[model samples]
Target: MNIAVLIKSVVATDESVTVSGGEIEDTEAKRVINPYDEYGLEEALRWKESFGGTVTVIGAGADRAAEALRTALAMGADEALLIRVDERSVDEHATAKLIASAISQRRFEVAWAGHMSVDNGAGQVAIRVAELLGWPHAGAVVACELTDDGKLLVTRDAEGDSEDWELTLPAMLTAQQGLNEPRYPALAGIMKAKRKPLTELTPELLGVDLAGEEASPRTERLGCETPPARPAGRKLAGTAKEQAAELLGLLRGEAQALKGRG
Candidate 1:
């Protein structure tokens, strides 16, 4: 069971976010392992413990992203691979391409990643990487098991429901919330992680063509603005009938305002 887990470094949620030129200015923002990706790492570590194999953590980002990989290593991953993308901004497509290329060079039975990164919340990279590798993908997986006949039994969230699936090896799975509680790195593990093997690769080394017009992002952000402040809640201070009538009146007023805008 040679498992590979994808981890991402994300801006801490408690920090205030500031956008500049349609991008978040996060140069000095406190960074941590994406909360969702932590589930993926935890699941992979559990699999390794059960089946007895190596777990490699893979990531694609700038240099600072190595810290997240280090954290994963501290959490019991055997090795870490950092696909260093020189560009400041990387879309989901490019990220998938880079990671898929790196995974292609290694022998892996399964690839795991978060359903979405907290920073961007696109939730597309794992599926896209599966497409690039021509493998089956199960997203939002909350439970996973390896069967004797070499099949993956996974339970995943389908909208508000749960679905069970059986997939073959070399497949991809995206971890959702409620999968498992992520374990914190112990002091001994943290110390060992400093000496773990961490490899860095470039797009050229992976034979990925990141240049040319075709490689450009399919979508571009025109601009970004903060959402309007939320209005205060209003208490209905009347009987049921009166409250219903007041709600209807408010709805009608909102409808008329929309009509006027149109």
Candidate 2:
């Protein structure tokens, strides 16, 4: 089985996020693989180990994203494909179209990616790619493994419960966390990754026309505002009756908003 893992280069989760001029400033923030994408990569690596096939990690981002792709190679992907894009200027649909174009040229039995990106958290690329490929797709997958006969056994969270299904090959799956614990790259693996094949692909080569007519979402950012801070609570230095009355009043006032009766 040939596997392709989609990854996104995102700002480190620990960094404080700031938006300036309608764009996120992450010039100095550390970049890493999306946490859920790591789970997808680990799952792909496991499949490769069992089936004796190649695992390729692909990403769309600025040129500096090669570093994130290299990290995937260090984690045992056979190859890496970097699709550089100025993410700030592209919408998810265009990004997905580019990825789908690149994937169309690859010979793969399965594709994997995160359920959503931490930075943008759009959660649309995977599904759109699957649609473009006309393949079976499963999203928000919390657990995945290969069956004895090579089908995919997928478990997902749905409607407050977990569900499982077996899917045939040539499918796209969006991975969620808790699927499996990802292994850290050892020093030896990191050194060997330097010699691994890293393919840099352009949008043109991938048959993606950035300027061509395509379906993209219409969005307008009117303004940005911080949420109101919570009000300070008062300490009740009275009997339980006083506390009960205060609590009832608070509930009646705030909870009534839910029913539009405020």
Clashes of each: 0, 0
> What tens-digit string does per-residue lDDT give for candidate 2 at 111-185?
999989997798999999999999899888988888888788889978578999888889999888788899899
lDDT of each: 0.88, 0.85
Model 2, residue 185: distance off in Å is 1.1
Cα deviation of 57, candidate 1, in Å? 0.8
lDDT of 2 at 189: 88
List ranges where model 2 is wrong by over 4 Å. 215-225, 237-262
lDDT of 1 by residue, 1-262 (tens): 8999999898899988777777667789899999999999999999898889999999988777899999999989999999988535568888888899899999999999999998779898899899999999999999988899999999999999999999998899999999999999999999999999999999889987777454445555677777778888888869999998887777669545334442
Native-referenced Cα lDDT, model 2: 0.85
List the RMSD of every prediction in angstroms: 3.0, 2.7
Clashing pairs in 2: none
